[model samples]
Target: MKINILIPVRALHDGKRRLSPALSATERRALTGWFFTRTVAVARSVLPASDIILVSAAPDLLAYGQEAGLHIVAEAHPGDLNTALRLGAAAARRKGADATLCLSCDLPFLERNDLEAMIATARPGAVTIAPDRSGIGTNAMLTAPIGAIPFLYGQNSFTAHSAAAKAAGLIQTTLRRRGFACDIDLPADLDSIGFMKNDRHIIAAE
Candidate 1:
C-alpha cells in the first residue's frame, strides 16, 4: 500500500508544559525523550524503519531518528503541530506514499496490533481517527491519498478533524482503540495499565 507513518514531536525543551504542576522542566524534557523513544519503537514494530518518519526541528531528535534508521523529515521550525504534520505528509507523498498515518508521539500505550487493526479496516478516500481517552482529542489519524483534509490538531481537534473530512466529501470514521487512545499528556494520563508495564503490550496477538 506504500504506507507511510508520520510522528510529530515538539522540541523536548518545549514539550509537556501542561504538566508543569507535576513535573519540573528538566523532568518533562527527560520524559519527552522517553516517550519519543517508546513511540518510535512501537512504530517500528508496525512498519518498516524506512517507512516511519519523525518530523521535528530539534537537532537531537532528528539525530535520534537518523540513528534509529527512521526517515527524518525536518520540520524547519517547531511551528504549529498541524503545519508540521502537513510538511511530513507532503514529504511522504513525494516519497511515493499512497497512505499516511499521522501518529502522536506521546501515545505511551500504543501497540502494533492497534495499528494493524486500523490499517486493515481503513477505507480509501476516508479519514479514520483514533481519539484520545477523553474522546475530545485525536491521538492518531489515517488518510489515503495523503492530504485528503486539512490537519486540525488542538483543543477539541477530534471534532474539527471529523468535520473537515466530511466537508471534503470523504468518509469519516472514529476507530476506538485502547492502545491508540492512551496518550500521556497530564499527570492523570499515567494511570493506564500499559504504562505500568512500560508499554510491553501484545504486539502480535491482536
Candidate 2:
C-alpha cells in the first residue's frame, strides 16, 4: 500500500504554547524548530520510500520542508490542528495514498523502526493510536482510507479517538513505545526526554 506520512505544524510562535512554563517565548520558538526538524528527520528516516507531506501555517516551515525534500502543503492562515491535518490527508488521498499516518511534531525521539513496524503490522479497517507517556494523549495515529474518521486531538484524546474509531466501524488499537510515547510538553516531559539541560537546537528565552 502507498503510505503517506502527514505532519502538521502550526506557526513556530504559536506551537507548543503549553510548554511556556518550562520554556520562554524564544525557547519555545527554538523548541518548535527542533521539533519540526527532528520530526521530519525521523519521518524521512522511517518512510524514506513513502510520500511525506508537511502541512503548516508557518511560511518558514515551507522552506525547511523543501530542503527536507518533503511535499509542502500550506495551510490556511487561521485554522486548528485538525483542519490542517484534514487538508493534508485530502492532499495525500488525491495523490493516490492508500493510508495516512498523522504524527505530532513534538516527538523528537521517534525512530524509523517504530514507523516501519507499525505499517508492517497495520490492518485495514482499523485505526492505530500510539499513546503518549501518560497513555491518555495520542502521539501518532494511522488512519486508512484517509477520511475514515475525524481527527480529534486534545486532552483525553486517546479515549475520544478510540470512540470515534469505533463509531466509524474501525478497530482501535493502542500501541506504546518509548520513541512514540515521549513528547516534549511539560518541563517534566522535557526532563524525561533528557533535553532540558542542553540540546543544540534549543534557544533560551532570556
Candidate 2, residues 27-134: lDDT per residue as tens digits? 898888877887888889877623899998788888888877888899768588788888999989998988899988888778888888678756678789999988
lDDT of 2: 0.83
Candidate 1 lDDT by residue in tens digits, 1-206 = 77889999889889988877766676677778778888899889989999998899999999999999999988766799998998889889988998889999887668889888878756679888999989999989999869898888999999999999988899877899888888778766655443342333312111
Per candidate, the number of residue pairs that clash is: 0, 0
Superposed by TM-score, candidate 2 places the C-alpha of residue 70 at a distance from the truth, in angstroms, of 1.2
What is the C-alpha local distance difference test score of each model?
0.83, 0.83
Range of the 10 consecutive residues with the lowest summed lDDT in candidate 1: 197-206
Cα lDDT for residue 104, model 2? Answer: 87
Best by TM-score: 2
